[model samples]
Target: MKRSLQITLLVVVAALGLAAGLAWQAWRDQPATVPDATGTPGSDARSTITSLVVGKRRPDYQLPDLEGQARSAAAYDGKVVMVNFWATWCPPCVREMPALEELYETYRDRGLVVVGIALDNGEAVVDFVDPMGIEYPILIGEDDGIDISRDYGNRLGVLPYTVIIGRDGIIRHAHPGEIDLEQARAYVEPLL
Candidate 1:
C-alpha cells in the first residue's frame, strides 16, 4: 500500500507539472489585448505596436520613472539599450535583478543603458529596488507597461521580457525569460 501511494503521488506531481506547462503555453500564445483603466476591455493593443522584429526600429513610448520623470526610447539615442519589463512580485523577475544590475554596471561606461519598466505600484517598486540596490533607471507603468511591451514585440505580455536595441536604434534581440549574467553578456556584448 505504501508503494502504491508513492506511485500515485508521483503521477499526480507529473500531471500537475504538465498542466502548468500547458497553461503557460496557452497564455503565451493568446492574442494580445489591453483593458482600460476602468477594467473594461480596451482594444487589441497590438494594433498600435504590430509584431516587432530584430532588425526593426524600437517602438516609441514615454513612461515615467519612479520620480515621475518621463523616459523614452529617444533618450537613449546612440546607446545600446536593454528595456526589461518586469514586476516587483514576480519571482523570476526578482531573481534576474542582480544579473541585470551587474550587466548595467559592467557596460554603462560603454554606452549600455538598462532600463527596467516595473508593471506595478511605484511605491512597491521603490521599496523592492531600494533594498536590492538596483542602480538602473526604473520606470513605473502599472497597466500601460503591458501595452508598451507589446510595442516592443511581446505578443503574450510575458514578464521578464527584454529587448536589446543597438546604438543605431535597431532592435538587436528579444529575450523573453529570466536571464543570468552569462546570457546577458551573450546578448549584450556583441551589440556593445
Candidate 2:
C-alpha cells in the first residue's frame, strides 16, 4: 500500500536524523581543542585560548538585566567573575545554568560574580530562570551577544561558552562547551 510505504519512509528518515544528531553530540563531547591566538592547539576544552584577550583583563560590557536596568561589568570589579554566554534555545547552555547558579551562590560571599549573558529573547527566559531558582544576574543580549562572546575566544560561536576572570582582572580560563561543578570548582577555588 502507498500509505504504508510513506509511513515506513518517514520512520527511516527520522532514524537517520537522530543518528546524525547523536554523531554530532559524540564529536562535540570528545576532548576537543580550539587553538589559541598563536595557533597552538590547547590540550583540552578548558584552556586559556583562541583570543589574545584570554589571559588579559575582562572586557567591559554594559547590558540590561532581566528587569531592564543597565548593568556594567565595572560594578563587579576586583571579584572573580565568570561570564557565561548562553541562550535559552541551546540545550547545553540551559543544562549548564544550574551548576553556574550553584557556584555563584556558594562563592558570591567570597567575591565571585557569575554573569549569564543570554542571546535569545522572550518571557521564557524569566520563566525558565525563576522557577529553577537562578539568582545570579542574567543579562539579555539578543542584539550584541554573539559579538561579545567572540571577543573572549568563541571562535566557533558555540553555546555555553564560559570565561573565568581572576580577582586581579586577568582572564584565567576560557572554556567552550559544558562544564561540570567539579571542573568549575577546580577553576575557581584557587582564585578565590
Whole-model alpha-carbon lDDT for candidate 1: 0.83
lDDT of each: 0.83, 0.81
Candidate 1's displacement at residue 176, Å, is 0.7
RMSD of each: 13.8, 9.9
Sliding window of 10 residues with minimal summed lDDT for model 1: 34-43
Worst 10 residues of 2 by lDDT: 35-44
TM of each candidate vs. truth = 0.73, 0.74
lDDT of 2 by residue, 1-192 (tens): 999999999999999999999999999889966433221236443343535566787778888888989997888889999999888888878888889989999999998999999987736677777787889999887768788887777767767888898988888877777777877888899999
lDDT of 1 by residue, 62-149 (tens): 8889788998879999999999999988898998899999999999999999999999988888888888888999999888898888
TM-score for model 2? Answer: 0.74
| Highest-lDDT candidate | 1
What does candidate 1 score on TM?
Answer: 0.73
Off by over 4 Å in 2: 1-51
